[model samples]
Target: MDIVNYTLKEYFDQKKSPCLSFNVFALDKEHEEDEQKWHRSDYFQVLLLQEGEVSQGIEHRNFDLLKHQISVVFPHQINALQMGDNAKGIVIQFDEVLFCSDLLKNELISYNNDLMHKLNHVALDEETFAKINHYGVQIFELFQSLSPIKKEQIRFYIKIMLLEIIEAAHQNYQGFRAPDELDYFARFKTLIEANFKSKRTVSYYKDQLQITSKKLNEICKNKTGQTALNIIHERILTEIKRLLIFSGKNHKEIAYELGFDSPSALNKFVYAKLKETPSELKQELSKIYKY
Candidate 1:
C-alpha cells in the first residue's frame, strides 16, 4: 500500500495557530472512516488508548494496544492504526520544534535525544494510567481554549506527560548520558540523518563535528553502546530496507540513488549486514508485511 502523508492543517480545518505547532485531541468512533489508511507525517504522535483495542503497524513491525496502553510514533514513520468500534483515546501530535526545541531546558536536552530514537509501547498500572489520562485530558481541554495561554506553557504540560510515560517504560531508554556527551551524540545523529547516504564513514562525521574520530566513537559508545561506524551502518541499513520495500526502485536505481559505486556494491553491503542479498531481503519483507 502507498503511504499517505499529512500536514497539521489536514488534521482539522481550523486556522493554524501562530504560536503553536502542536495538537491534542480525542480518538473516538467518529474517526473510524479515516482509520484504515497508512500514513506518515513529519511530526511525533503519542496515543493514549484508554479503551478498546488498536492494531498499529509502524514500518515493518506491528503493535497491538489494549486498555491502559500508550504507543508512540516517531516523525516520518509510515504507520497505520485500526481501532475497534468502541475505541477511545487521546492523541498528542507535535512537530520537532515543540519536541527538540533549543528553548528546552539544558537537562531535557539529553532526555529528548534519548526519546528520539526509542519507540515504546507501554502498559501502565492503574494508578499511573489514571494520572497520565488526567494530564492528557487537561491538555486536550487547554488546546480547545481561546485563553491567552502561551505556547511554552502548553509545551511544559506536554513535557510532564511525556516524562511520566518515559519513566513508565524506562527500560527502552538505556538511561541518560552527561549533557555534554549527549550534545555531541545528538549532533552526530542529526548529521547522519542528513548525510548517511553520501557519507558512510565515521571520520567524515568526526571531521564535520570538528572532533577526533576517537572522541566521536567514545561518545557514541557511551550513549548507545555501539561504535560510531556501527551506528552509521544501522541507519544506512534501515534506509535501504525502506527503499527496497516502498520506493519500487530496482537494485541498480537504488544503488545510484544511495551513492554506491555500482549495484553489485549495494548487494555486497546488504549481504554483509544481513546475510541476504537485496532481492532476497525485499521478498522477505514483502511476505512479512504483505505489501
Candidate 2:
C-alpha cells in the first residue's frame, strides 16, 4: 500500500470535528470500505473498539484488534483498516495541544520515544475493558452536551482520557522500550524539531545544542544516513508539501509561512531539494490521492 503522511492540522481539516473539538466516529464496515488505500495521519489518534473486530495493517505488520482493544497510530505510517461485519468503535482525534504541558508535549514530540511501543497493537483485557467503557461513556455524554461554552472543559477531559489510556497501555506492555538512544546527530535532530521555524542556520542549531558543525554532520549522517542539513531541509520540505497540497495558500504566503526570506529563495529551495517547481510539487501531491 502506498503511504502518504498527514499532520495533525491536515487530519482535522479533512475530517469534520464531530462532537465538539473532538470527533468520535462509530465507523461501520461500509464506511471502512469507502476509506481508500493505506494512509498515515500526523495527528495523535486513538481507536477504541466497542463491538465487532478491528484490525489493521500498518507498515506491513498486521494487527488483530479485539473488542476494547485500542490502537495508536503515530505520525508517518501506512495504515489499512479492516473492520468486521459487526465492527463498531469510537475513534477520537484531537490535537496534542489539548494535553500540551511542557513535559507531556516534550515527551510526545521527542522523535526518539517509546510512546508508540506501548500503544501499538495494544489489547485491553476484561478489567481494562471496564475502565475504557467508563471513559467511553463519559466521552459520549460530553459530546451530547454540545456546549461551546465548555470547550476548555472538553479539552481537559479528552486529555485525561488519553493519558489514562497511555498509562494503561504502559501497564499492559511491561516490555515496552524507549526508542534507541539518539546519537550526536540525532541530538541535532532534536534541536532542529525544537527550533526549526525561527533559527534556520546550522550554526544556530549547533550552537544551541553545544555541538560543532562538523561533529553534528558526522553524527547525523551515521544515525540517519543523511547529512544534518539535508535532514533539516527535508523536514521543512515535507511541511511545505503538506501546506501546498492541503491548503490554498498562494506562493508568497507559503514562502513567509515557511520562514523563507523571499519568494525567490523559496522557489530555489523547492527546485534544488525536490527537483521540481512549487506548482509541480503541489500538483504531484494532489494526484497522489486523486482516488
Candidate 3:
C-alpha cells in the first residue's frame, strides 16, 4: 500500500493490530514502481533484505540496504522508496500498541519505549535473519488466525516479536547512543516532539522531568553528539523550514503554529539558527526538493 496518504485509522482497519503483516518476494521475479509517498503515523517498520540491493532513506540518510540486512523506520519519519535495477525484501509493519492494550506497562514504558525511540537501522546475518523471522512468522500466523477478541493474543505475539526486534536491531547496530545513556536521550527526544512548540527552553524540559539542564545536556550529547539546546534549535528550525517550504502559510501563520511570539521573533530565530532569512531558506529548500 502507498502509505503516505494513509492515516493511523486506515492502517488500523487494514492490518487489524495488534497485527503482523509479512510478504517475501524475489528481486528477479517481479517489477513494480511505487509512486505514492509513504510515511507512518503510529507504526514501526522493518524491511528485511532478501537479495540484490536497493537505495533507501531514513530521516534523510541514504542507506544501501542489502540481503539479510534490515532497516527500521519509525512513525512520522519520512520513508523514502527503494529504487534500483534490483530490489528485494520483506517489509514488516506494526503499531506501537501491538505490545499491550494497557499502554502503561513498564515494558512499554522503559526499555521497549526507549528502544523504539532510538531509531536504529542495522544489518544482520542469515542466522540472525532466521531467528527474527521465526518470531515475525509467529506473529504473522497468529494475526492471520485472529478473530476480534483474539486481538489480545495477537498483541502478546507481537510483544514477543517486538522483543526479538529489539534484539535484532541492537545486536551490533552502530550510529548513535551508548547503551546506558540511550533511554535518557530517547525520552528527551520524545518529550521534544510532544512539547517543542511550547517548551523551547532547556530548563523547561529539565524541570518537566525534574532533572537539571546539565544532566539533560550530558545525556543528549553522549547519545547524539549534539547538545540539548542544539537539538532544540534544530527541531524548531526544521519545522520552520518545513512550514516555509511545504506549506503555503505565511510568516505570521508559521510563527503561530510554531508558538513564536510573532513573525519577527520567528524570523530572528530562523536567521540566528540558519544564517539566512526565512524567505531565502524557503527558496533554497524549494530548489533542492523540486520533485
Candidate 4:
C-alpha cells in the first residue's frame, strides 16, 4: 500500500517560495483521485464545498459536507475526500509559515483551541456563505495576479476570511460560554500528542500542565467526556490504528516504535482495550480498506 504524503513544496507546484506558498483551486471530477486518497499534508487547508455533497474522513471520524459548508483540516491529520461527480468547491491551502506572526497565530489559536469535534464542518447561512465566498474569490484572484504587494494583499484577505469564519463558528453555538480553563485542556491535548509515546500517565500531564490530576481529569471529562487517562489511551489507540492501516510495519515493529517493551505488551494492551489482538485488528482493517 502506498501512502500519499503531501509535503509543503510538493503541494505548492513544487515551489519553495514561502511568500507565494498558498494555492486556491476548484474541486471537480477532473481532479486526480490520488490527491483525494488518505494523505497527510504539512500545511493547513480550508475547503468550501459549494455545489454538491461529499464525504471526508479525518483520522477515525468521517463527516459529510454539503453545499455552503466549509471544512478545516489541520496539519498532520490523515484525511481522505470523496467528491460527487457534480461536486464544486474551492480549496485554499496555505503554508504554516503564514501564521508565524504572533498576532495571527494567537488569534487562530484562541479560536481553534476549543472548537468542538462536531463543528469542523460549519454550515453557513446563504448570506454568510456569499460573503465568505466573495472573500475567497478575491484571495484566489490576488493569488493569480502578479501585481506588486500581491502577497500582502493575499495575506490581508486570508486574515479577513479567517475572522469571518471564527465569528460564524462562535455564533453557531448560541450563547456559547468557553470555559476559563479551556486553555489547560488545549495544552493537555498538545502535550498528549507530543508525549503519548513515552508518557502515558495522567499525572505526567498534570505535572507538565501544572495542574492537579483531579483538576485535569475534571477538565478532560467536561470537555471530551473522557477521563484524562482515557483520553491519553484513545490518542495512542488512534495512532496505532492509523499505523496499522497505513503502514507496512508488522506488529512487533509497531510495538517497539510505540514504546511498548515487547510484542506481548502491545498485544496485551490492544486485546484489553479493543478485545482484539493487533493482528486480528489489522486483518479486519485489511478486509475493509484492502490495505
Candidate 5:
C-alpha cells in the first residue's frame, strides 16, 4: 500500500503554476470527496468546521470535531476527513516558506508543543467562532480573486487566525507557563528536526546545544514530559513511520537511508517502539485506508 503524497500545487489544482504557496477551498461535497482518502501533504492545513461534524485522523490519532471547531494539521502528518452531509467549513493550506519572513517557525513550534497533549481541534465559543468564520470567508474569497495583493492579504488573515488560536490555547492551559528552559528546548527541537535522519544520540544533541546530557534531559522532562533520549527516539520513530508508509522503498533501502546498520536493526527498532513489525504496521495501515 502506497500513501498518497500531495504537494501544494497538486492538492490545489494549480499544477500549471506550481509556484503558488497557498490555497483555500470550501468544505463542500466536491472537496470532501477529494479529501476522503488518507494522504499527507507538504503544507500546513487548517479546517474550520462551522456546521456539521467531522472525524479526522492524524498520524495514529483520531479527532472528532463538532460544529464551530477548528483542527490544525501540521505538514507531513497523515490525514483523512469524514464529514457529515451538512458540513459547512473552509480548508486553508499554506506552504511554510510563505511565512519565512514572518519568523513564524519558532512560534509554530511553541504552539504545537502547547497542543501536544490535547486534541488538535479547538472548540470555539459562539462569538469567537463567528469571528473566525468571518476571517475564513474573507480568506477564501481573497484566494479566489485575481487581486495582485491577494497572497499578502491571505497571509495577513492566516496570521490573525493563528494569533487567535495561540491566545485560546494560552487561556485553556492557564496553569501551564513557559518554562525558563524554553529557549534551550526549542533549539533542541529545531536541531532534532534538522538532524534526526543522521543523528540520533542525546549526547550529540546536547553537544550541539552546548549543554550537558543530564541538563538536556531535565529540560525536556520538565517541558515536554519526556526525557531528551526519549525525544530523540520519538523523532526517529516518526520519521521511520513516515518512510514506511509513504516512501515506497524496501526495508533495506529505508534502513540505509535512516542510517541503520542493517535491516534487522530497523526491524528491531520498529517492533520495540510500536509493538509491531514494519510489515505488520504497513498492513494495518493498508486495512485502515482501504476502508
Candidate 6:
C-alpha cells in the first residue's frame, strides 16, 4: 500500500498541547490498521522499547528495535512499524515546535547526526534505560490522568526524556562541533528540507542563510562530513527514493513533480547518484522495502 502522511490533528486533541504518550499496545489499538502500514507523520516520534521487540522500517531501512534500545523518527520520515503481542514500550509523539525550543535545540542536534545515514537507533545501557523509562512512565501517566494535563509538566518530562537519549547517544558517538557551527548546519538542513524539491542548489541555500558558499560548505562538512551541495543532493535523492517506492508515479510524472526538465534528466541524476537508472533503482528499492 502507499505510504500515508499523518497530521498531528489526527492523533492529538487540538485543545491540548500537541504532545502525546502511549504504550505500544494502546497505540496499536488506537491506530490499528495504520500501525501496520507504511506511513509518515508531520510530528516527531520516539519509540522506547523497554521489553520485547518491535520490527519497523524507516525510510526503507529495516530493523528490529529490541529491549533497551530507542529509535527516533524525525518528521516526514517514511516508517512502517509492527508490534508483536508481547511488545511493551512507550511511544512519544510531539510536534516540531515543542521539540525545537531554544532550550532544547542544541541538546537535540546530536539526534540529527546520522540523518543522512539513516542511523536512528540508539543503544542504551540498563542504567540509562531505567532513567529514561522513568521519564517516559511519568509522561505516560500524565497523559492518562483524567484531570487536565499541565502542559509544562508534560513538556518538562519530555525534555528530560530526550536529554537522557541525547546523553546516551553522546556516550556512544563523537561530540559535535561548536554551537554556532551546529546552528548553521541545522538551519541549512531546515532550508533544504523545506525547498529540496524546488531548490536544489547550494548557492540558493548559501544566499538564503546569508553565508558565503565556502562557509556554508565548511559548516555542512563539519556537521555531516559532506559539502553543502552534497547534502542537498542527498535530500533530493531521498525524496526520489520515496517517490519511487511509495508514490507509484512513473518516471515522466515523477520528473515533473520534482521539477526536473524531463524524465531523461531525472534518469541521468539517478544514475549519477546510484550508478543506475531510475527503473533499476526502483526495482532495487522495491526489493529492499518489500514494496
Indicate which candidate wins on TM-score. Answer: 5
Model 1, 1-291: lDDT tens digits are 556777665554455434245777799766655556887775778889998999887766787888998888876666788998767899988865355432343454445554543545677777888998888888887878634454445667788887788766664444544346437877898788679879999889998899999999998765545689988987777678768866789999999988899999999999999899999988866642331
Overall local distance difference test of candidate 4: 0.73
TM per prediction: 0.56, 0.58, 0.50, 0.59, 0.60, 0.57
Q: So what's the TM-score on candidate 6?
A: 0.57
The positional error of residue 116 in candidate 2, measured at the CA in angstroms, is 1.8
Q: How close to the true structure is residue 90 of candidate 4, measured as C-alpha lDDT?
A: 83
lDDT per residue for candidate 4 within 1-291, as digits (tens), equals 234677656644555443345677777766548557887776668888878888888766888888998887765566788897778878888755453344544455556545644245688998898898888888777767645477667767877887787778767755555545547976897788668889999889999988899999988755544689987887777667767866789888899889999989999999989899998987765543341
For candidate 1, the C-alpha RMSD (Å) to the true structure equals 14.5
Q: How do the candidates rank by TM-score, highest first?
A: 5, 4, 2, 6, 1, 3
Residue-pair clash count for candidate 3:
0
Inter-residue clash pairs, candidate 5: none
- Over 12-117, each residue of candidate 5 has an lDDT whose tens digit, in order, gives 3665543455788888888776578887676778888989989887766787888988887865566788998788899888764443332454556656554532
Candidate with better TM-score, 1 vs 3: 1
Name the better of 2 and 6 by TM-score.
2
lDDT-superior candidate, 3 or 4: 4
Candidate 3 at residue 50, lDDT? 62
- Higher lDDT: candidate 3 or 5? 5
Residue pairs clashing, model 1:
none
For candidate 3, give the lDDT of residue 143: 50
Of candidates 3 and 2, the better by TM-score:
2
Per-residue CA lDDT of model 2 for 1-291, tens digit only, reads: 345554544544576543223455566755575344666554556777878887687654787888878887654445778888787777766643333343454565532345555676777787776777667666666766556544545556666776667767777776555544343443565667667766678788778767789977876644334567876886677667757755679888989988899888889999998799998877765543222
* lDDT for predicted candidate 3 compared with the true structure: 0.61
Q: Give the Å error, residue 108, model 4.
A: 6.5
The TM-score between candidate 3 and the true structure equals 0.50
- Model 6 pairs in collision: none
